[model samples]
Every structure is written in structure tokens, then in C-alpha cells.
Target chain A: MIEKKYRDLIDKLIQKSLMKKVSWNKSSRETEYYVHFKKGSFTVDNWVNDSSVYVDFTLRNANGIEIVSQTFEKESNPEEFNYLFKLYKAAEESYIKVDETISSIINELDEEDTVGKDEEDVLPF
Target chain B: MKRFRDPVFALIVYGIGLIIISFGYYFIPNDLKNIVNYISITGTFSSVYGILVAYAQIMSVRETAENTKLKIEKSNKRVMKILSVSDLSKAIKIIPEIQNYLSADKDESALMRLKDLKGILLNLKFIKDIEELTSDEKFVDALNELSIHSANLSKAMMGTKTGLNKSKIISDLDNIENQLNEFEGYLKYGNYD
Candidate 1:
């Protein structure tokens, strides 16, 4: 009986992964996520009839811009949930890395603008 | 009441009586020529008294007006100075790096310079706002250059954290200095006119 239950769990994990795929795009200063349905009808009626699971994610930049995205799949299982969680973490790390790189570039330019000036000379009038 | 009490009213009544007496003298027979001359002299004296009273009233009004004008000018100067000081305080808060970069001596010098500027602005003798300092063409040009410099500085500050390009910072400081120099020249020359 334990062997049968383990086989069932492995089958369910494979079924979930084959059912959904999450894809994302960055454009116009925003990021969007989409979940694709790999099986069954693509019509609205089919989507409405399907059992969907939702995943939530957040992205933040150094300049304090934050974006939250949510996507829904018709079916999800525990194994798929674990995989999605890992993907979400990786995305967040990439976003912060990009934000920090931009911030450093801007700071460098500011330091160059103040060279060779006597203390008496820096009033904005 | 005493005859000469209420000096203003007394003078008015005395002048009116003198006019009546002079008229009566004119109508009297030729025997009253000496009386007519004496009455005319009295009328002239009373009119001179009324003229003195009117002169005093005019002088009082002039003095009051002058005092009021001086007070208004002083109040205006005080209000303007307060506004300028408030603005300066805000500017300093927005740019706190100014305090970090200056040496102790330079900091004191900057403080004293600001104090002197405030004194001139508050001195009721100077009648213009600091913003008006840019009215001169040279000052305006310098101010525009300063704006560009500040923009550059902001961009540079936004760019790097470590190993910051000091040359860009120095250039921006130079721009700011040039603008301030122009402003000071105009101020020292009393260019408000």
C-alpha cells in the first residue's frame, strides 16, 4: 500500500508540471507574468470550468519601484508549488541586482560633477 | 468761560468779531477813520492767529504720515527677511552634504557669510528679495549655469557609490562658485536700482 501511494504522488507531480508553464516579459518599466495551459480546450468556457491555482510574486528596485504579479493555473499540486516558489525567489534576486547596478552608475556621474571647486564657489545662488 | 480759553474757538470768534467791527467802522461817519484803522489792525491780528493754528495742524499731520511710512517700511523689511531666512533653512536641509564637506574654518566662514547676507536683507535699508538678485543679466546667466551644474551633480551622485568620479563633483562645484561670485558682485554694487 505504501508503494502504491508513492507511485501516485510521483504521477501527480509529473501531471502538474506537464499541465502549466509560467512565462514573463519586461517592457515599459513593468514586468508581467503569464501561465500557459498545456492541455485541453483554449476557450473561455474551458478556462472557467477548470480548477485554477494562483501564485503571487513581487519585484523591487533600488529606486523603490515595486511590482507585484499574480498568475493562475487551472490545476496545481504540492510539487508544482515548490517549484514555483523557487522560481519566484530567483526572479527577485535578478531584479535587485539590476536595480543596484543602475544606482551605482548614477552615483558615479554625480561625483565627477564637483571636482576642482573652491569651497567659496558652490552656492546655487 | 474765560475769554481766551479753547484757543481754536477763541481765535475763530475773535476773527469774526474783528470783521464785524471793521465793517461797522467802514459804515460809520468820516469821524470814525481812526476807529476803522484800529479795527482793521485787530482783524489782521486775529487772522494771523488763525493762520498759526492751521500751520500747527498741517505740521502734525505731516509728522504722523512720515512716521507711518517709516513703520511700514520697517515691517516690510522684517517680513522679507524672515521669508528669506526660512527659504535658506529649507535649502540647507535639502543639501546637508554642504556641512559634511566643509572644514571647520570653511564651515564658520560659510556661516558668517550667510549671516552677513541675512543682515543685509534684514537691514530695512536694502529693499529687495534674494530672488531679485537674478534680475541682472550677468546674474541670470550665472544662475542658469548653476542649474546645469546641479543637474550634472545629481546625475553623478545617482551613478556611483564607491570610487566616485571626483572630477565631475569638482566641475559642478566650480559652476556653483561662479554663479555665487556673480551674485555677490551684484549685491556688493547695490544693484537693486
Candidate 2:
């Protein structure tokens, strides 16, 4: 089983992500989670073996191109793992900001459509 | 005290007090006749005040009920406005295709897809509610950026290859998809509902 802290982090990330998918690797003894966004996507792999807990952070571009991939173990590289987490959060925020703007654009365009329509054409029927 | 605040209960209590007063009126001595009259006058004023309070309470309750009903109707209308639009899932599907084209360096194809997206946005029905959203500064600025970047990219695709901002256009489209998803989420599970 994955450690409690790692599991909680994975859950939080998955919750924040727009389109998320989760899976388990029986042979590898790891849990994999995928969060897909329009700008990019990221995958988190959590593994707990006999000695230490391992987490892999893989960041992908819009076209599923692997831009950054790194693995960190809890016992050794706590600072590096924290940095990876920070990157993940930054990416999530970027996606959120972009999404807000695009939504506004679409809404504006729709508003124009409504304005262009004559009053007579707007009947509920 | 709580029961006294209830108009019907207060009226019943007052009615019983009047009956008791009428029954005890004859028991008063002749020497205190003036005092009895004074007490009766005070009681009358108190009764009148009670009635006035009860009327005010009734009117207040009625006003609150009307306001709540108006609020509900307004919210329902807002929900209907969002639901009445054309299928936004179409835009969701088109966004990925546009991204694929952009990633593949097919600028011509990406431009066509962007036009298609614009067409879809412009053809959505019952979108008058969107006017309120346009007032937000961040949203307005973002829309403007997307428009400017899109125009620039379109020009480059046409002929002017001097400032081909492909990355910027891709980023803009990405942001659009994110915003579209957010809008869909609000429509599906908004706090207003």
C-alpha cells in the first residue's frame, strides 16, 4: 500500500485536475494517476516497496510530448520532491488561468450572437 | 414571551384579559372608581400597541416571502439561460483537433479549426446572459489577448511570415479549452443552483 501522505497528495492533485484518470500496477506495486489539461498534462506514480516510497512526476505538453520527467524517493531528495510538487501546482494554476480567459472569450462571442439576433427571433418557442 | 409574539396567541390572551376585566369591574370600590378608569385607559393603549406590532410583523413576513420568491425566480432564469445554449461539447471536441493540427505544424488546418470554433461560438443561442460575464476585467483582457494572438497567427498563415507566433497561438487555444472546461463545470455544478 502507498504511504498515507503520498496517497493524500495524489488525491488532492487528482481533485484539482480537470480530466483525471487513475489506475493501479499490480506487478510494479504502484498507483498511477493522469491529469489531462488543454495546455498540458501530468502523471503521478506512487510506489511503496520494503524500504522507501517512490514518486514519479512526468509533465507532458499539449501533444503528449514529455517535457519533464523526474523520480524522487522520500528517504533521499525531499527538497527535490518538494520542487516537483511546486512545478505541478504552478502548471495547474497556469491551466486554470488559461481556461478562465478562453471561457470569457467564448462567452463574449456568444453575447455577440445574442446581440446580432433580432428581438423577434428570440422567442422561447 | 414567545407565545405573546404570535399574533393569534396574543389576541386570544388579550381577549381573555378583557373578559376578566369586565367581570372584575363591578368589584372595585366607589372611592377607587377614577383609578380603575385610569388603569382601563392604559390597558386600551397597550392593546392598541399590541395590535400595531402584530400588523407590522405580518407585513414584514409577507415582504420577506415576496423577496425570497423573486430571488428564486431570478436564479431559475439564470439557470435556464445557461442551459439554453447550443451543445458546448462540440467545442470541447474541436479544441483537441485544433491542438493536434497546431502540434503537427499544419498552420492552415489549425486556422480552419479556429474559424470553426469561432463559428460555433457565434452561433450559440440564448447567450444574452454572457453580457454580464464580459464585464470582468481578467476575462475581458484574456479574450482580447486570444483575439490579438489569433489575428497575428492568421496573418502569418496567410503570407506575412515575419512574426509567426505559433507558440503564442497554441498557448491561447490551450487557455480557451481550459476556460471552456471551467464554464462547463459551472453550468453542471454551480453554487447558484
* DockQ of all predictions against the true structure, Cα-based: 0.01, 0.01
* Model 1 spans with C-alpha error above 4 angstroms: A1-125, B1-38, B97-142, B150-167, B170-193
Report the alpha-carbon TM-score of model 1 versus the true structure. 0.31
Per residue, candidate 2 scores C-alpha lDDT tens digits across B78-185 of: 776455333456777888897788789887887787777755544432255553433334333333333334444574566532335466566667777777676666
- Model 1 C-alpha lDDT per residue in residues A30-122, reported as the tens digit of each score: 121211122100100011112343333322221112222223342544454444444433443343455556777778767857535577777
- Give me the runs in candidate 2 sitting further than 4 Å from their true place: A1-125, B1-14, B23-28, B31-50, B61-70, B73-94, B100-141, B157-168, B179-193
Tens-place lDDT digits, model 1, residues B85-175:
4543443332334323432324343333433332332232233655465344443332222232232234234441122233343443355
Best by lDDT, which number? Answer: 2
How many clashing pairs in candidate 1? 28
Docking level of model 2:
incorrect
Every candidate's lDDT: 0.41, 0.56
What interface Cα RMSD is found for model 2? 17.8
